[model samples]
Target: MNKTLLGSIYLALASSIWGGMYVVVKIVVSVIPPLELVWMRYLVAMVSLLVVSFITRQKWRIHKRDLLIIIAIGIIGNTISIVAQETGTMLSSAQMGAIITSSTPAFMVIFARLILQERLTLKKGFSICLATIGVLLIVGADQVDLSSKLGGISLLVAALTWALMSVLVKRVPSEYSQIMVTTYSILVALIVLTPFVLPRLQAINISQLSHPAIWGGLLYLGIVSTAGGFLLWNRGLQMLNASSGGLFFFFQPVVGTLLGWLILGENIGLTFWTGSIFILIGVILVIKEKK
Candidate 1:
């Protein structure tokens, strides 16, 4: 199989998994604060990944050289970007979150140029713009408040840092398994989040967390979205460069909308279908160009 094709599949699947996360995140965050949700998310993911690593009989040793890069990946993407994303979602509307953070591919292109010196071909550039427009169309500026400046800024922060972290994944040596890399990085984030989240735990009604939805949401986020999604994303980036691979992130909202329509009986009109076409064309352009 072509590496680019496989990479594209991995990237698309990762984002699609996260698309269903919209409803779950809202439910979990209502019961758990932003930071604490992040902490617990990583905790669930770390434990899940570590168990997989052990079963796979993977080498656990990291060369001193790559340790810092992995740590940076964890802290930047897993910690900061997520913290900002959840916080921004809490402060702002989910529609706002989707529209703003979808800028990640553009930022990834910029960072790839700066950090990796990857050239942005004309095809790549146009596809990004088209997909971005598709995103805007799908999640139109309805009931959004620009007055929520803080939330907007936090989401922008999330986009920028996540982009940087995605680009940085290219720096880690390919000899290491992405599963291991993802697990270790998540562990790093878990350690960083523990202190802050611990103190705030007592204030929340602990009994509320025992609900099946809360526990189920956190587990899905940890095992499927975090562990599985991050590993697939990281592995895909290994096969494709950051600039091209990041385009697949656009699928998140498309999948979210699709799932909403299918599962939640959310209405999907012509605009939604039209936007889906744009996103598909954008993805196809990248895949063909990379090939």
Candidate 2:
């Protein structure tokens, strides 16, 4: 019932959901372009969020001053960062994408320090090091392609922007419902992406909708990954400090690897288990920290 513990649960659930999302994306993305798929996911999430808001009788109104931060969060994290992440993945290998983007928590620590003035305790610092090592071991640095200069740079942009957006979640007045913030922020992303996504809509085979997997996959992605995932992640950040809260982002790879092995029958070896242990230690360290 402690705030940190509850927040940790929220963050973990969000990241784990995202980890599983990769499998779904792998299936659905073949039927849909990444950006188009993202646009559809947001549209689904938008409707779902609105329905929840209406049910909860949550106020849609937000302070005028906070509007800027909300828009910034939308543009930075939801739109640009995601687009770049997809672009990077397309240009580079999964190993490279996994390795590059796992630095998000470390970047979150720095942003939290500079923007929110959160102190970097030795424990938090050490935990990040541990998690980063775990990611490298799991992702396998040997498979990374040095030739993917643009892809590498794009992924770094994704990491940096997402880290900044996560920290910015702390800046929105705590009085506002994170649900409202998340919903409206996603709406902003939809608006921004609409112009780009609309034209491509014609290209997609409407016939693809007849396939159960494609339709079902988008529904899960929108409802679970975008709506549920973003809400839990933002709500978690409300209760926990950005620096420490960011540690949960590491759960994505761990859960992803596990689900990959379980669902996709992906091969795993000693390094996967070893990396998971390190990641667990990193998250457990912060959860135990009082401050």
Per-residue lDDT of model 1, residues 79-147, tens digit only: 999999888988887778889889999999999999999998999999999999899889886757898
**Candidate closest to the true structure, highest TM-score:** 1
Q: Give each model's clash number.
A: 0, 0
Q: Which stretches of candidate 1 lie over 4 Å from their true place?
A: none
lDDT for each of the candidates?
0.90, 0.90
TM-score of 1: 0.97
- State which candidate has the highest lDDT: 1
TM-score of each: 0.97, 0.96
Report the C-alpha displacement of residue 75, candidate 1, in angstroms: 1.2
